[model samples]
Target: MSDTSPPKPVLFRSYYRDWIEVYKKNAVRNVTLRKYLLTLSWVERLAPDLRLSELTRLDYQKLLNDFASEHERQTTMDFHHNIKGAILDAVEEGLLEKDPTRKAIIKGREPKSRKTKYLNHFELHKLLESLELSSTPSWDWLILLIAKTGMRFSEAIALTPKDFDFSKQTLSINKTLDYKTRTGFLPTKNKASIRKIQLDWQVLMQFSELTKPIEEDELIFGSLGKIFNSTANHNLERRCKKAGISVISMHGLRHTHASILLFAGVSIASVARRLGHASMTTTQKTYLHVIQELESKDIDLVMRAMSSLN
Candidate 1:
């Protein structure tokens, strides 16, 4: 007589790998793909024996609690989002009875103190004055470009003489350098990132003279060789200390540019385009504090204008 036995249930980790291979592997950028792979590693580590068919809301909560114990709240939220996508698909495929992630509570460790993210007008002026921009391209030049144009480091480093239009005083942002992998050129961060940013006369003239000797297509800052974001941050930190301003990261230069524009009463839409943000929502969300402060000033102006009408 032949005996029949039940098939072993599929491991949740295995299902997640299949989900990533089918849904995420080729559908996202290499940097984004690596994030999914990282989520997979965490799944394997945290739920090694969890079966797809046995996933429950309780089980999912426990897994998140475990993850949260090691990370900050924002990081925990990102991790939850990454895994939730796969879990939802698994449910639709009839591999699970229901979504285990619904109503799941996200918790995490306390966030550490953050560094100052931007400089004010006077602080920025001092920082710029501290930079020593010489005839040759240097990190200081890169710092100044970001401070002026709000360009991402990758976008600024990928720039060449051909990207600049001196007559129009605009710079084309079409690609970004793959500084992390040393893989040459890559597409911009998003479709919106491919844009033309107008340059002020001073910056246009400075760059025109600077790029005169370099090849039209050669990387503006690539001569530095295998530059990392940290390299730029160190240079910026030195300048900040020398100028006696608050220390900020390389990314802070971006924040500084955006903040200055917003404070100067430039329209949010215009600043959003200059920053190459995918949406004005991103810009508004990132600078909500600045917006609120500006709104208060607007209210004061409104009151004064109304009183004058009497």
Candidate 2:
């Protein structure tokens, strides 16, 4: 037998980060990669100073036991499970001794459901206008792009000049950047996420202008050697505060765009294609409120016509 053992220091960083890298390398979308990294950051905060090998089931359980609400606890519990799941994968790959978080009981937590808060059309336009008035013009364009494209913030930030097809007016959103993996080659949350979007005229125009002085392999939104979204977001938040609007996430623009498209009589497939959704189901679920409104309006018109006929 060889005298060498596996690197004990390998598991020192967050296991969640390692899994994120795995996802990135697998070609995951940038947005999904970022969310996973945020989840990992939360885990790191709860177990600050603890190494990967230092994790215990009890320690993991302890992190979730202190939530004020069952809902909060459960939400955190799922996040806990994800981290533990990552560690388990490491163990399977001979990266660690065993799954230290496996036997840990998340007993105090209660089940809870979660949903994303999306923005409305008026709110979106207001924010877009406000962003334009800021010192950073890049954010104004970047925010509008996501709102129109329904790209996750990271996906938008990780976008490169090569990802755009100005001639076809199409965008290929395959690679993503994450805190764990700063590259575009990563696995997105779902199989369908690795899809393409045909850009609208406005998006194409903005992209063309942005890439005017840049190269194809270079990131379209590159800054001083990094993606520019975070700094843009910070500036955006400051601008929103000055405008007396709530500083919402960049992703909220995605919801606003979806709703507006549905209201404007765009087909679900068309919207899904632009948003790079894997299926119509995702597009429908996301815009269910707008769909219901359309249904209600249709019913009213139908009833009015029947009465007129009588």
Q: Over the stretch 1-310, how does candidate 2's per-residue lDDT look in tens digits?
A: 8778766553434566767786554464555456567776665665566666665665556665542234355566666665666777778877667666665655444444433355566666677666552233366667777877888776777777888889988888876666345644454546666777778897688667767777777765565355455665676677667666666666666776777888888999988877768789988887888899999999999999999998
Which whole-number lDDT from 0 to 100 does residue 37 have in model 1? 92
lDDT value, residue 98 of candidate 2 = 63
In order, candidate lDDTs are: 0.93, 0.67
What are the RMSDs of all candidates, in order?
1.6, 7.6
- Candidate 1 RMSD computed on C-alpha atoms after optimal superposition onto the true structure: 1.6
Question: Model 2: residues >4 Å from true position, as ranges?
Answer: 1-69, 72-116, 132-137, 180-184, 224-232, 242-246
lDDT of 2: 0.67
TM-score of each: 0.96, 0.61
Model 1 residue 115 distance off true place after TM-score fit, in angstroms: 0.4
lDDT of 1 by residue, 53-91 (tens): 999999999999999999998888999999999999888
- Please list all clashing residue pairs in model 2, or write none if there are none: 23-187, 24-185, 24-186, 27-186, 27-187, 28-186, 28-187, 28-188, 29-188, 30-176
**Which 10 residues in a row give candidate 2 its minimum summed lDDT?**
65-74
